[model samples]
Target: MAHREPVVVTDEPTIGKLVVDASRDVSGLIQKEIALAKSELRVSVKAGGLSIGLFAGAAFLGLLAIIMLSVAIAHFISFTGLDLAWGFLIVFFLYVLLAGLLAFVGLKKVKKVRPPEKAIGQAKAIPGAFKGKS
Candidate 1:
């Protein structure tokens, strides 16, 4: 005959201890989530900075190209028997018109910019979610 050892059963955890444990777990989970968000934002910020630098470099090059093209256009106008001063003046007025058009378009686009609705909705729902009311 085989001998069997006596089994002991432990008592269930108290409500206070359970609540404390759950709170601790939730706090730790929130901390980890915050850390993850910070990590993602750090990466995104670095990429955004790099993209801005690249755009700036491209813009500088474009400015140089525009200046050279303007000089060439002025020379072409002068070659066609217009006075050199008149050529430059015409080019200046042309650039002014172009600038006005660009400003108008940019303003329109900027006016269309709105806040992130989905993120805002989720943020507003967070309190209700924690209260167990979806």
Candidate 2:
């Protein structure tokens, strides 16, 4: 790798020159960081979107399979001396019960999801550190 020129600190170096150099370096660093983030974000977003779409398609097909399987189960129930309508209702009622249970569980889980306290605390510490108060 090529070497950078060493900075010469001498009595003649004014504060203004030092500040200007620091500003330039910081600006360049920010620009490069932004470019890197954009490239990474573009690739990550494309891959994540493709995976999400494929998974959604798979879930849709899986749902269809489950529906067909449920209908078969209901038909089997009908063969057990119950009326066809009653057999289907039995399956329907069981599904309703499952739906209610899942809804309750999901709501409980959602209620548990709160803001990320650790991340928020760390973020709040930044300004204090920058201001030399930490």
Candidate 3:
């Protein structure tokens, strides 16, 4: 049989040492969590910025397409023997009429909006309630 070394049992850690170690571990854990969150946020922010740029590019292309469609429509009207200038003028007037109609509808919708009376009443009663007056 081989000779074996005697095993020595260590004393239990003191409460103060244990507490200090636990607090240190928790602080390290909090720092690591914060670092991880910052790393994730960096990636998210980059993705968000890229997506906004792509959306802006798409919007610009859509506006260009709309302008081309408007020109095509004007040319089609001129093909019907109307003056080219009159065709463009007719399209311009149509846009103005559409703008006026949208404004009128928007005004009606705005007029229908009412203040939150219930919330206002509750807010007004807050001071009385705080003074123990029901």
Candidate 3 local accuracy as lDDT? 0.96
Q: Give the winner by TM-score.
A: 3
Best by lDDT: 1
Tens digits of per-residue lDDT for model 1, 11-99: 98989999999999999999999999999999999999999999999999999999999988998999999998989999999999999
Query: What are the Cα lDDT values of the candidates?
Result: 0.97, 0.95, 0.96
TM-score for each predicted model, relative to the true structure: 0.60, 0.56, 0.83
Q: What is model 3's C-alpha RMSD?
A: 7.0
Error of 1 at 22 (Å): 0.8
Q: What are the clash counts of all predictions, listed in order?
A: 0, 0, 0
Q: Which of candidates 1 and 3 reaches a greater TM-score?
A: 3
The Cα error of candidate 2 at residue 125, in Å, is 16
- Model 1, runs deviating above 4 Å: 1-11, 97-134
Number of clashes in model 3? 0
Ranking by lDDT: 1, 3, 2
lDDT tens digits, residues 1-134, model 3?
Answer: 99999998889898999999999999999999999999999999999999999999999999999888878889999999999898899888888999999999999999999999999999999999999999
**Model 2 clashing-pair count:** 0
- Rate residue 67 of model 2 by lDDT: 93
